[model samples]
Target: MMASAGDMDTGSVLLAEKVTALSDPAAYPEFTAAVTAVETHFSWVFLTDGFAYKLKKPLRTEDMDFTSLAGRTRNCEREVYLNRRLAPDVYLGVVDLMATEDGRLRLFGSGRVVDRLVRMRRLAEDDCLEIRLKRGLVASEDVARLARGLAGFLTSQPPLGPVSPVGLRHEINTSLLDLAVACDGCFEQAVRRVTARLLAFLEYRSDMPGRDRLVDGHGDLRPEHVFLGPPLRIIDCLEFSDALRRRDPVDELAALGMECERLGGAWIGPVLLEAYGKAAGVFPPAGLCAFYRGLRALVRARIAVRHLMEEPIRAPERWPRQAAEYLRLADRAAAELTVPSGRRPSSSAAL
Candidate 1:
């Protein structure tokens, strides 16, 4: 049975307490040089002077299961293996968090292994493309360079070849329904129209084509994961699901384009697509790319609204607006897909 969208509800784990204790620089000799920790939806990352260590929270969700010690270790192993494709130097490897005889925890030890961490080389925050874009520091040349590099990376990967049609269409269908429910009458008519149209279009073409074109890819391609540097590094791929990671390059590109537009770097999408077009020698149909963009937008919208549903109480201040914005973007995407997509149109705000 398919997992409901509700499965994404964030939950805490008991291991987080242990993970927190490990975050103290005093706990480990190797981290004496630096002391800081960043927490995310499912992990804790301790940053040292030269590197970082990530410990997954013991939680099970629809798409991922990190609840078991062995499961987390496997996830860590896969995380390193898969991420190395995009950021080889940055994703060094996985290490174990072990309890020593003196009753202190240490990484890379032979004591009773209790947990694991994905170790990585750290990059400066200023080099993050998302931050650069927000600060108006990202230039056309920089984006163009990113486009070329990303295109090269995509083209270099071997195709997964024609497999059975995937469950992605069904996943999108559920996402649309979930978004409609989450919107809570926000822009009721437009959201419904978008929901209906998108569902119909997706249902009519339920069988996604070009399975032969699918590649092992970075499933999550948000701007945040992209590092704008002489040495480009894309990290934090969705590491849990094999089905999610096997994707058509165009879909991955479209997801990135959608996020770029969300971040106000609307120009980057077209430029990246153009660059990819040059490198790959062919592109997915413009209508299809538009459809993917729309789907991705709605996906984000559902995720944002989920925060309201899943949180203990008062959700983030921006959750509602963020949800609404993504819904509108989805509406625009559905509309765009209806047009002859030989060329992109300019009146985006009007959408």
Candidate 2:
């Protein structure tokens, strides 16, 4: 039976109550000094002294759906299972948010299940690679260690299938349209040229390099999701779509390199490539790396600009600058596709 409008209102109030309760330190099983609620695009993370609990919003987007209880539960389970690949110790388990007989909500309460949350051991903020990079605390050795770890992990994965150049082109076209709408057409021509050059590079090779090496990998590989340790921990694999998560190892590495350069660690990019090459036993072509990096940069720029499309836009002042910066990086990387003999461009090319 379809829920009446009044019933939906009641459900919303219940959700709000649950969220408010989760934000309270008293709702936790142990004594928490405080609870800090951090909101992201898809979920709410309630941070405590030693743990973080992620609750998915009952929302649907183009790529994901968490609008039903069953869907959210399934995603919660998937989040823990997939993240365990790289951060086994961090993703603890999933817990239910329940409503009490007295119409109160609480975590793990013995009553009707109202929602689900993914529980995790909170990582140190200072140990995050992004934070370390920003503080100028990341060293070449750190990058080397990360590269070795990532290379071993990536090489061990079984190949899912081959990448389709036509499919990728379609994705690029969709993102270009998205960018045009998001940035008021400011970057339409520039991005079109960059994407066209990328297609040319692929066509010139006849066979797309590394197309058959796509694996179910960590989809989001920014430094922010990487923890720097003697034993590194990476979290937040894109848990929604298997297709999106399947990617060439080089493409993933190139995306990470692009992010490192964006974070003011240009030296880190080259060091990562060298170490990963030695570990993986095959150096990726410099031209292909450049192409992947540029492609990722354009995607990232679109993502940054798309924040404006969200209701109650987050950091309204920041997205434009971020999008412009990524566009700059994309342009620089696209230019490298034209270098003769696949000669690697200098890492110190000014951003």
Candidate 3:
């Protein structure tokens, strides 16, 4: 039972309200003094209808953290700068928060330096890709268009010089490790099987070719972060650190594929890969797609676990259920790797 678009939108609005309440004047003065309103979630997002102010929360997670004011501000600035690379029309600039003589909060930088916000042009909620996906409004053509668009972006960008193979290995392993810790006993056997598959993949590919062509990518590439319009827009990149953002493009593609499968659209994996390959002149490495797909599942599992741990009371009891969904996908992906035909294609395979 997947949540409907309407339900998800309602949830987002509720989350917005919760975020506002949590960051209200009485809750945290520094954040309150910096923005007029907060939109809450992952980070405290403040907005004025016309513009958005994103303030990183001083929270830490296995994947990311904005523990200090300076760290938050740095990440905020990075968000604006990096997002502009893909979405120039949106992502205006960083707004600074300034304190008045009377001790009132105000937006600065464009005027005076008081506090900081990652200012961006506000987009309509209805236009969000996540909303569209939930509503069954995202057509195959839309997915094709998005794939072509992303492929073009990757092709035009220069490769991020040789990423350490060890680093890539660590990225996949760390995600599985975190998932194992998070799941504990709920799905011990499933988690263990997935972990073994991940380790095997890493071990088998330790000496694969073309490891130097990896590039900086959207660590969190999903429908929610994409905006569908005349031209599709990918936003909300993992700006907390470059380590996560820099990786094999296949890993990014795998993240999208796993999400699509989870959302009941397994066909999208091959569709997107075919489209991307047409634009980039190459598909993901042989035998690696399944591995990355498993890794993506593991990452989602970690996120589900994090939600359960961080917001036990607020977190849905359905989290373990959702985590199970990802685990199932991981198993499927791992199984695909064992098939003789799975490793046959180098660049002509559909997915």
lDDT leader: 2
Query: Could you give the candidate ranking by lDDT, starting with the highest?
Result: 2, 1, 3
Which segments of model 1 are wrong by more than 4 Å? 1-13, 31-34, 108-110, 161-166, 200-208, 311-315, 339-351
TM-score of 2: 0.91
lDDT of 2 by residue, 238-346 (tens): 9999888888888899999999999998888778998999989978888888988888999999888878877768899999898888888888888888634654323
For each candidate, the alpha-carbon lDDT, in order, equals 0.74, 0.82, 0.66
lDDT of 2: 0.82
* Model 1 Cα lDDT, one tens digit per residue, 1-351: 111221122222246555666777765546466568887777888888878889887666778877677778899999999898889899988887776787666775567767778989989899998999899898877777877777888788888886333355555556666665665666456666665555555444434455577888888899999997778889999899988787778778888988988888888888788878876787667766787788788778877777776544244777888888887788888887453334332332112
Give the per-residue lDDT digits (tens) of candidate 3, residues 1-351.
Answer: 011121131222233333454344443323344435643445667655355667554466555655544655777888888887777888987755544455434453133342356777777667677787677777778878988888877766678776564665565556566666665676667776766656655555554425566777777898778887766778888887787788678778878888877877787788888788877788776477887888788778766765665542344676788788888998888776553334332221111
TM-score of each: 0.85, 0.91, 0.77
The residue pairs in collision within model 2 are none
lDDT of 2 at 202: 62
Which numbered prediction scores highest in TM-score against the true structure? 2
> How does model 1 score by TM-score?
0.85
- Pairs in steric clash, model 1: none
How big is the positional error of residue 300 in model 2, measured in Å on the Cα after superposition?
1.0
Alpha-carbon RMSD, each predicted model: 6.2, 5.5, 9.0
